[model samples]
Target: MTPEPTLAALLARLDRVEAHQAVADLMSSYINACDLAKDIDRIVEHFTPDAVWEGVGRNIEFGTWQGREAIAANFRGVQERQPFTYHYLTNQEIRVADDALSATGRWLCFEPSTIREGTLPVWIGLAYDNTFVRDGDQWFISHLAVDTLFATPYDKGWGVEMFTPVTAPKEPSHA
Candidate 1:
């Protein structure tokens, strides 16, 4: 017969389970903030003070943002370009550290976005790799990196093209 785990072992297992769920909840909250276009302050609360947000692969054009202030600015820019979007996250996997002070996670995101008011509708496929830190009892994002798999027009599938040209928003004319 298999031996039962000690109380200490059971407690440790519970801790890990809680940590995993906390990390997942944090990601969901972050995504919700983005989708809702919440205040920059609220959005940045999900990250550590010195957190880094960057883009890789086809998303390299997004550059990188370091620290909470920069991250907030980046999101502001995103809000301007992507006025409306629905982000769906799936295939999420999170692993908590043995000490339960940190965790790493990955997720696949599928987004349908309307760019620049009603100018264009696009479909975006992306992958996210995130690192999280536990402070006191709250978890914060330490680092977030995103890679774009595809960003194509809604009428055209990825099979037709991987990315659609995204131009900068035009300035209002005063005549």
Candidate 2:
């Protein structure tokens, strides 16, 4: 009979790889949360309690919130003010360090935030640079840094392509 791989051995093997799937999962949550554009709490569940989220749009926010609550509030502001636009994430890369518990990922994002009046209000090129940590058996976003690579005013008439709605995942029943 073959013996099972030891935890030490498994971790060592993982360290040699970039753990791209883990990074992809992180971005999946990001993309899913962005797509909802309604249920505001998804943003809170996506982040850890002390997560640091920043971007070109964080400041001059509609209002301020702190800790995980801050992220939820941010989502609220986002859904309330910004018209729904599809965000496309692509060209992602993850670099896993020798420490299996830590990793970093980079991805390019294109999205337009528009207003109800159909005015494209803001255009942004965002880079999601991440620091990850596993919470028990599950992975959660420990620290997220959003670098706005570029931003410009979206013309009033400009419209971006959007994917049609499918059955989106529901948030956990418990808050």
Candidate 3:
């Protein structure tokens, strides 16, 4: 017969499981808050005080913001630009550290958005790479890096032709 785990061993296993769940919950809450776009404070609370948020890829202007306040502002800016947005996340993978106090996760996101004055609704696919930190008993996002895979108008589906990166030609230098 297999020997039963000691109390300390069981507790360690529980801590790792809890850490994984916490990371998952944090990501879910982030997407929910963004979709609602009503409570910025609620979204800001998910991040650490010195957290960093970065967005890269072709659809939108790439930018990085540091600190909770800056991250909150970035989210607010997104809300302002996209009047309505529905975000979907899938294929999430979280890796908990041995200490059970930190973790890293990745998720795939599909976002359909309605712009304030735009005639066509836009759809975006992106990847999220996140780092989570546990402070006391609460887990917060330490870093969120988003890589936009594709952005297309709903009328025009995302196909082979849309695989190319969106780019703008550089302007002529006056000098």
Best candidate (score: lDDT): 1
Q: Where does model 1 exceed 4 Å of error?
A: 116-118, 167-175
lDDT tens string, model 2, 54-95?
542332212223368666655655565565656788888887
lDDT of 1: 0.84
lDDT of 2 at 68: 80
Query: How accurate locally is residue 32 in candidate 2, as Cα lDDT from 0 to 100?
Result: 76
Q: Tens digit of lDDT per residue, candidate 1, span 78-174?
A: 7878888888999999999988899999999999997755488999888999999999889999999998788888888788967886644233211
lDDT of each: 0.84, 0.59, 0.78
Better of 1 and 2 by lDDT: 1
| Regions of candidate 3 where Cα sits further than 4 Å from its true position | 1-3, 58-61, 116-119, 160-175
Model 2 ranges with Cα > 4 A deviation: 1-11, 15-19, 56-66, 115-118, 153-175
Ranking by lDDT: 1, 3, 2
> Candidate 1 clashing pairs?
none
Please provide, for model 3 over 1-175, each residue's C-alpha lDDT reduced to its tens digit, 9 standing for 90 to 100. 9999999999999999999998999899988887875578988889898888877665554578788787777666666656677889999999999999999999998888765434447777889989999999999999888988877767777863344333321221111
